[model samples]
Target: MVERQEQAASDAVMTRIGQSVMLHHAGDREEARGRLLDLWTEIGEDGDPLHRCTLAHYMADTQDDPADELAWDLRALSAAEELTADRPAGHEDASAARALYPSLHLNLAADYAKLGRREAARTHLRRARTAAAALDTDTYGAGIRTAIRRLETRLGENDPDDPRSGPPRQRS
Candidate 1:
């Protein structure tokens, strides 16, 4: 069926995205971005949401500009939202599509934080937490939760009223 063929193509794109992520992790950031950009050109902005989500999510990490990073992360989030809306439960791609949401939101929070958008960062962080709750406590879920905790700590440190920001200053 057409759906199965589409799934196959989407899965191939995800595999390529994974390879690009590996390249980025291996310190070939620009090369990784180049590969992803090629994939994006092939997939187009309105292509399979699963492919777009995976590509954009990893693409954000390769960006040198905070604003560009935020843009890619936002794209990933948008694709994820579309995937959730379009994928029906029990559909072949539904589980795989749904699994991207928590990390997509988490990346958005990080991107917003990088751009000093505190309120936006906090909002996306909360969304990430909510999405994470639906994930089973496997390796992926644990990693997402850890990233959320780390980002929360970083955000709290910048807030003067946060108890975890450290003890109050002693009188001079």
Candidate 2:
């Protein structure tokens, strides 16, 4: 059936993305980026939303340029939005896609912070926190929470009105 074929295709794309992520972990960012780019071209922008989300998420990490990273993160977020809109409530795919929003928004916040877009970073950080409420505080969720806290501290330090400001405090 058409649905089965789509699921298979989506699985294949995720496998490829996993391989590229391994390549990235092995420190061959350029090769990983190349592999992701090839996959992106194959998937196209309008491809399966999950495929787009996974690819864009990894592709963002592979970018050397902060601007490019932000662009890919945006793509991931956009694809997640599309996935959310397309799926009916209580569908497994819908739940899976919803699970990605926190990480996607977190990455976007980091990217914006790197680009010196404080307001944008704060906005995405807030969204990430809101999305994270649906997640249990397991290892993955804990990691995201840690990252959120780190970014919050950093942002707070830059705010003159923050109690944590006005001191050259070292980050742990």
TM-score for each prediction?
A: 0.84, 0.88
Clashes of 2: 0
In model 1, where do residues sit more than 4 Å from their true spots?
1-7, 157-172
What does candidate 1's lDDT look like per residue over 1-172, in tens digits?
9999977876788889999999999999999999999999999988987788878888988999989998998898788778778878766556776787788888888888988898899888888878888998899899987788789788762333445546644434
Best by lDDT: 2
Candidate 2 per-residue lDDT, tens place, 73-128, comes to 99998998888899896877777889888899989999999999998998998888
| Global lDDT of each candidate | 0.83, 0.86
User: What TM-score does prediction 1 earn?
Assistant: 0.84
**Candidate No. with top TM-score:** 2
RMSD of 2: 4.7
Model 1 residue pairs with clashes? none
